[model samples]
Structures are given as structure tokens and as C-alpha cells.
Target chain A: MYKFLTTFLPKPLANIAMALWYFLLIIMNLYCGIAFAQGTFQYVGW
Target chain B: MRLLIEAILFAIPMILLAWTLPKKYVLLSQIIITALFIAYQSPLSFAILGTITFGNYYLLHKAVLRKSIKFVISLGILVLLIVSAKILFTIHDHWIIPLGMSYYIFRNIHYTIESYNGRIQNESLLFYLAYNFFLPVLIIGPINRYPEFIRDWQRRRVNSEYFSLGFQRILYGFSKIMIIGSYILSLKLSAIISNIDESKHWLKVYLETITVVLNAYFQFAGYSDIAIGISLLLGFRVMENFNFPFLASNMQEFWSKYHMSLTSFCRDYIYTPLASYFRRPMLGVFITMIIIALWHEITLPFLIWGSLQAFGIYLAFIFKDTPTSLVSKNLGRVFVFNYFCLSCVIIDYELAEALDIYKTLFFIN
Candidate 1:
């Protein structure tokens, strides 16, 4: 998957896509973190 | 949040050390860092874990050198007693199991068995300690083998690709845990179930069960991703723990994929020998399932859960040779997936609650 993204797409476009994906993950994590802080999210332990 | 924070904090220094440490000092640095991390988390856990690890190493070393079956048996019994005590204590609320005790004990057992089989080579105590205390996998593990770890260490080097891949993997883990698991399956699904009309009891129960199972999958697989990613960054490629188990078309395939490391370990250490001894493959499957179930917790519900799983596997085995087409294969996948989700209800709830769920599902009440 990494190779396909980096190789098939143009370098600039690939970089943009990667950035967008990372941005999505960061936003989700931040939202979840806030939910956790509010004690609305359940944390499962191993 | 605290665990995630501590893992990140631990990873940064470990990554730096992996990249910059002198060759001779790398092992020492790893040992010290891991020791400090464990001690910081809980001094009692550190002490107990330290004693078990060192004691196991010493006994294993002697058993290997002397090739003494008596020593090996004694060591095995001792380890078993410790694990049993921990489980019994936890069940009775008498004491807390030391951090990562389950994972490390299994590692020690693996080492002991392999050493007795002459599969293990002579290694220094420090190297053995490093393998046991390796922080990336200490808590939740892929149950990495000693030989693979030693090989990774021997050939380790700084690699940019590994670093990039590791970070990407960690990002994937966090996303799965936060967005998909905690948010969608857990919170949203629970809210949906609670808001359902009480008359739609079956729908609510089914959804709740699915939510619990899927939530467990994501949470576990997410943590595994984080552990694997961290190991990658540290230049050790640990074994993969999961492999898209829901896509399995049969119970055998599901077991092989879900919790790949643990299942494989049980297959190797438990099932094969039991099967050979009893000359009954079905008995092996049953015993292995029970062990896997009880490994999570020693409760009556888990025992029943394990029995149900074994029964499911037996049914699958009986139907193994049946002809299959595209539709049948898809049907098989659905059956396998639902079987797992439903069986999981047993382990997730008390016997009475689970019975209530089943009664509701079948309209028994």
C-alpha cells in the first residue's frame, strides 16, 4: 500500500494524500482524547 | 491516556538509543531503560517481575546445560504454580498480578521448552534479560520468540524505511482504537442500543453482542499494532498478532488468524502434544480451546465459552470436505463470524446474564 501510494501517484499528490491521512488520524485522536477526559469514552485494558 | 503517554515517552528514548548507542553498550542501555520504566510504573511489579525473570533464566540455563529432565520438570511446575497463584489471587481479590506477568511467563515457558529441545543456543544472562524485559512487547505482546529477537539484535542497524513504517503503523493503531473502536462501536453503538424501544429486545441484544466483540477486536488489534510498530522502530520485527480474522470461512482459519501468536503458541505447546498423547485430534482441540479460554480468566463462563468454541471447531472439521461455491463460502464466513461474536457473549458476561441474552435471542422469555 505504501509503495503504491508513493510510486503511482505524483510525488506532490502523494505527499498531499499522506498529509491528509495523518491529519485525519490526529483529529480523531484529539477528539477521542477529549472524550476520554470527559469520562465518556471507555478504555479497554489488555 | 496515561499508558499511551508513557509508551510514547518510552519509545522516544529507546529509538534514540537504538540509533546512536555504541554497539557494545546497546544491550546495557536497553536493560537499564526497561528496568527503570517498570520500576517507575510500579516498584512491586518491578521486583516480582525481576525475580521471576532472573530465576527462570538461571533455572533454564542449568536445565539446558545439564540436560536434566528433573530440573526442567521442577522449573515447569514452579512456573505453573506462580501463574496459578496469580490467577487465583486475582479471582479472589487477594492480590494484583504483577505487570505483564502473563505475557512474560509464557515467554519463559517457551524458552524453557525450546531450551530442553536443544533449539536454544548459549547466550549471556544480559541478552536473556533484554529479551524478557523488552518494553515494546512487555505489556501486551506478540509473544516474540527468543531466537528471532536475538537474530534481530545481531543484524540490527538504523533504517529510515523502518522508522517511517513504524510511525505509520502507530498512527493506524491510534486511529483504530480512537475512531473506530472507542467512538463508533463502543459509545455510538451503546447509545443506539439504549435508545432502542424495550420491545425490540432481540435487536438490542444482538447489536450489543456485536458491539462488544468488535470493540474487543479493534482494541486488541490496535494495541498489537502499537506494540509491533514500536518494535519496528527499535529495529526488531516482532511477529504479527492478528490477520483480518473476520474474513475466515471456518473456525480453523479463524483460530489461525485471530490472536495469531497466542493461538500458534497453544497449537505448538498444547495441542500437538495432547493430540499425540491421546491419539485423538478432537480431544486436542477441546483441551486447547479450554486453555485459550482460561488463559483470559479462570471462570466458569470462560470454561463454557471454551467448550462452545471447541464444539464449533469440531462442527467445522466435520463439514470440512463439503462442496463449496461462492455463496456457500460467503455463508461460511458469516456463520464463522457470528459464531465467534455470539460465543464471546459467554466470556463477556456472567452466566446468568448470558443466559438471559440467549433466552432473549431465541424468544424463550
Candidate 2:
């Protein structure tokens, strides 16, 4: 049943799932860049 | 009374940072926060906090038995508290409602649902209390589930690696919140958000909106970072919160990347149950979103945000299930997904403001 559902679901979902993995990879880089940004922060005031 | 004093005195130490003084003395800081008042400075706030804590304790204690009826009862109760707080706060303007009630509600829900799902067979009251009120993840969360939380606890008998790793995560998180999140707030760009007068230009609004999104990421993700970091300092191994969610290519993938613990929690408990609502494989995926939005405590803006996300997920479900490769590209998917998410954040601002901005974004204006 599970296998049949996957087969019938079409290729777009697979493409999306694959795209999502790639997207996560890109986000990892963006996150690393952002994490290192703003060398200092002021916790209290504006 | 306590919340007032803390919010007041909190300013001084926040500037000086009580956290910096002695990492080992966190227990003392908490005791000081608690020793301030019988009720939260405001009565309404007190009720919300008290009620949610009641929900957390109530659900957790009930989870220990592993009985089917009690298990069901616990989840139902936790959900009820979440909805009640959100409704009361939103429609009635009940401010200072609860400090970390929503997050703890998730914690409680996690324990209950995990017990019901057969993921958690063993638990003790002390461990459960610590997990729920760990104080680090308490305010903002990485949203720990009980089974995984229990496993981590058992495995953490006495490992310095845990401490070392935990501190690294904490310091990094604290720095993120303190440095990165704060830096954005301090910029003049954020000032435009508050002064949303008719004088505000379209370009300025656009700039402010971008700032708001960045600020949201930094502030919330920073909170998670702090939670992870502090939990580490205290010898608890809370899970990581953000996984570079912003770079997600599609809405579905973004959901998986962001607030991952909550996303999975809702997926397992709400989405799964709702999926069972009808036999159709393509389901009322948005139903899960309503639960997710309500998790923020049922405000109108939050409801809209949740609904918008549900819309995104529903669309993703349709697209993914259909096998449309054209819509799923690395750069193209990221633009669509984040644009969709940014649209939701716009709606989260205010209904009138959201409608106006939507008109402009869609070029209806």
C-alpha cells in the first residue's frame, strides 16, 4: 500500500523532497554566515 | 508583583547580565525571580501562567500511568489550556498573559502524545518536571519530546562531552540572541516598524518588513540558542532548535526546517489525528496548521499566520503529490517558499496593515 501510494504520487513530490534537501544545504550556509554576523550585541536597550 | 519587579530589576541585570556573573548561580537567579510575588504583577497574567503550569504538571503526572484513558485525557486537557489562553488573551486584550505557557504546553503535549504513541514506556515525575520547567528552553524552545528527552537523560549519567558540547551551544546561542538579534533591533530600520503612520513610504515599509523578518529569525532563533546553551550549562541535552530554516527551497521543506520540534509535534499529534479525520490521502492539511497557529495561543494574527502556513503546506501537498518538477528548483523554490512565509508574517502584523500590504505585494493596489 505504501509503495503504491509512492508510485502513484508522481515525480514532483520526489523532486520537491530532493530540492528540499538541497535547500537545507543552502540554508546551512546562510545560517553560518548570519551566526557569525554582528560581532557584538546589546542585550538591554535600544 | 514578582513579574513587575523582575521586569523592572530585570533591566539592570539585563544590561549587566546576571548570566555573566556566575554560570553556576542560575538557580539563585530563578529563586530571586520567583521570590518576588504571589501572583504575576497583573492578575490576568497570573491566572494564565498558573493555569498553564497546572496543565503541564497535570498532563505530566497523568502520563506516568500509561493507561489509555488517562493518556487520552492528558492530551485533551493540554490542548484545552492552550486554546483557552489564546482566546482569553486575544479577544479580550489580556496582556502579560503567560510567560512561557505556550512552550510548556507543547512540552506537556509531547509527554502525553509520546506516552500514548508507545514511544515512552518509562518516566519519573522529577525528570518530567525538570524537562517542562528547565527554565532555559522554558521561555523559547527547542521543544523537547518526552521519549527522546528521557533517553537523553538516561544516557547523560556523567559525560563531560555533554558539558563541553552544551556550553558551546549555549555560548553560541547566547551570543546569537545578545549580539545578532540585538544588533538588528538597534538599527534605525526597525524604528519604521513602530511608526507605521500614513507618512511611511512604500520603500520604507518594504525595508521595515525585511527587517521584521530578520528580527523575528534572530530573536526567536536566538532564544532557542540561549535555551540550548543554558540547558547545556545545567547538564541537560536539549535538542537543536533552528536548522537554517530560512534557506528552505519550498514551503513544505521550510516547515520541516523551522521550529522543527513544534512542527514534528503537531505533525505527530495534530496532523496525524486530523489525517485520520477522513480517508482521503490528500487531506485537510490545513487542519494541522490551525493547531499550530493556536499553539501560539489563539490570537487573530496568530490564527491568520497558522492558516497561511496551512495554505502553504496544503499547496505543497498538492504540488508534491502531483509530481510537478517545474515548481521544485533550488533557487526558485526558496524564493517561492520564503515569499509565501513573508506574506504570512505581513498578515501577522495587523489585519488592516496586512490587507493593505497584500494589495501592494499582489499589485492590486
Candidate 3:
């Protein structure tokens, strides 16, 4: 999967895709973090 | 929230210190940060951890220097007794087991065994302490080895590649925990299952069983990813814990890929020695499985779960030499996957509840 991304896509396009992916992850993390603080999200214990 | 907040707050300064300090002082910064974090979280646990760390270090040093079998045996038994006490205390709710006690003890056990074999190079008490209490792996671990960690420390360097990769890996870990495990598996799939009709009891049972196992995998693998990623950021390359375990086509393959560190530890320290001692490989397999089960919790369900896993591996061994085609390989994957999912019911529920689920799954009625 990594090879396909780095090899198949243009460097600039790959960079943009990577940045967007991180952005999406950060936004989702923020949402989950807030939900967790509000006691709506269940905790997964070790 | 408190734990998360504290971890982030501590991690920021810890990472900064690690980057700014001389390579030699990096381990010291980690030790201090870990001490602060544990003390802040629970003072009693902090005290307990400190005692264990220092005591084990003293014992290990003596064992290594004297090369005495007696010292090795005594130290091994002492650690086991502490772990057993922790298990019993957990069962009775009489006392709280110090956080990360399980992970660190296994590490201590690994260290002891290796030291006895004269494989350990760095006998530095400082390195041992840092290995035990390294913040990322202290809670949930890949159980990084002593030799590898020492090597990483010696060759540690500042690099942009490590930073980028570490950040990316951490993001992947959070995504697995938050989106995949918590939201999709725990909340959404569970809600869907609960809404199903009672008439489709078998379907509900199957789906719920699969979901439980998958959720466990994601939760564990996510924590491991976070731990490994943090280790990477510190310029240390720790062992990988999971490698697409669900894709494995047999019980042996699955065990090899899933929780790679712990299983490999068992293979090396538990299974190998026992197998050689008894001269009966199957007996060793059973005992190792039991130890693995007891490591999690000394409960009847866990014992049964471990036995079932051993039996699965035994069957796989019997068929080891059988010829395989593409169709057979796919079938094997499906069979192994379902077998694991169903067996997980034993550990996830009470005995009678698990029995009922099995009956429902197999159409016993």
C-alpha cells in the first residue's frame, strides 16, 4: 500500500494526499476526544 | 481525560528534553519523566514500582556476577510470587496491582533469563530502569528486549525520518483506537446486533463473537502502535506487536503474528526450556498455553481459553505436512478465523453465558 502511494502518485500529489490524511485523522481525533470527555465514548481498558 | 491530559503534558516536555539533551542524558530525562508521571497518577503504585525496579536490579546484578543457578531460581520465583499476588489481589479486590506490573515483570524475567545465558552486554542499572519505566511502553508494551534497546541507545541519533514516521504511526494508532475500535466495533456494530430479532439468535451470536475478538485486536494493536511510535520518536526502534494477524491461515501462523512480542517471549523462555526438560513437546505446548492464560488472569475461563488455543495449535501441527491449494488456503484462513472468534467467547463471558452462546451458535437447541 505504501509503495503504491509513493511510486504511483506524483510526488506533489502524494505529499498533498498525505497532508490531507493527517488532517482528517486530527479532526477525527478531536471529535473523539471531545466525545470521550463528555462521557459518551466508552473506554477500552488494557 | 486526566490520564490523557497528563500524558500529553508530560510527553511534550519529555520529547523536548530528549531532543535538546546530549544523547547520554536522554535516558535520564526519560526516567525522571516516567517517575513524575507515575507519582502523579498514583503515589502508592509509584512506590511499589520503584521498590520492584531497584530490588530486581540488585538481584539481577548479583545473579549476573556470580552466575549462580540458585540466584537465578530465587529471583525467578520471587518475581513469579509478586505477579501471582497481584493476580490474587485483583481477584479479591483487596489491593490494586501497580500499573504496568505485568509488562515490567515479563521484561524482568526476560532480562534475568538472558543475563543467566551471558547474552546481556550492558549491565547498567540506569538502562534497566529506563527500559522498565519507559513511559510509552510502561502501560501497554511490545515488551522490547534488553539487547535491542541497549543497541538502539548506543546508535541513537536525531533524524527527520524518525520524527515523520513516528507522528504518522501515532496518527494511525489513534485512528484504530478511536474510529475503528471504539466507534465502529464497540458502538455501531453492537447497536446493530442488539436491534436484531431474537429469532436470529445464531447470527447475533456469531457477529457478536467476531466483534468482541476484532475489538480486542484493535484495542491492543492500537496501544502497541502508539507505544512503538513513541519509541521511534525517542530514536529507538522497538519490536512490532502485530502483523495482520487476522490474515493468518493457521493457528500457528495466527499466534506468530498476533501479539508477536509476548508469544515469542513464551516460545523462548517458557516453551523451549520446558519442552527440552520434559522431552515431550506436546506437554510443553499445554503448559506454555496454561502459563499464557494465567498471565492474563488466573480464572477458569481464561484457562479454558488457553487450552482451546493449545488444542487448535495441536491440530494445526498434525496437518502441517498436508498439501495445500489456493482453495484450501482460503478455507484454512476462514476456519482459523472463526475458530479464534468462537473461542474468545469463553474469555469474554461467564461460563454459563459462554455455554449458552455456544449452544446458540451450534444450534444445540
Give the winner by TM-score: 3
Tens digit of lDDT per residue, candidate 3, span B48-145? 78887788777767545556754566466756766677578757876767777778778888887787788998999999988887888887678889
> How well docked is model 2, in DockQ terms?
0.07
Question: Model 3, DockQ value?
Answer: 0.57
* B1-365 per-residue lDDT for model 1 (tens digits): 47667967986897788779898888788888888888998898899778877777666665455667645664566568555865786578867677787788788888878877888885689889889889889888889999999999888988887888888889888878888888888788788899999888799899999999998899889888988999999899999999999998989889999999899989999999999999999999999999888887777888889999899889889998999899988998999999999998888887889899989877896
The 10-residue segment of model 1 chain B with minimum total lDDT is B62-71
lDDT of 2 by residue, B1-365 (tens): 12222443433442233336454343345434432332444455445555555565565555465477776777778777777767787778846556667787777777766665777677654555445545455555777866666566555444566656655554555445444555445443466466766565655556656666766676677667656655555456677767888766667888888888888877777677767878543354677777777666566677777777767766666667554455556664667545754666545477787778766655685
Q: DockQ of each model against the real complex?
A: 0.57, 0.07, 0.57
Q: Can you list the residue pairs that collide in candidate 2?
A: A12-B323, A12-B324, A41-B179, B1-B41, B13-B17, B86-B297, B170-B229, B249-B333
Off by over 4 Å in 3: A44-46, B1-5, B62-65
To one decimal, what is the Cα RMSD in angstroms of model 2 from the true structure?
Answer: 11.1
User: Once model 3 is optimally superposed onto the true structure by TM-score, how far is the C-alpha of residue B285 displaced, in angstroms?
Assistant: 1.7
TM-score computed on alpha carbons, candidate 2: 0.69
**Each candidate's chain B TM-score?**
0.95, 0.75, 0.95
True contacts kept of 3: 0.52
Ranking of models by TM-score: 3, 1, 2
lDDT of 2 at B136: 55
Docking tier of model 3: it is medium
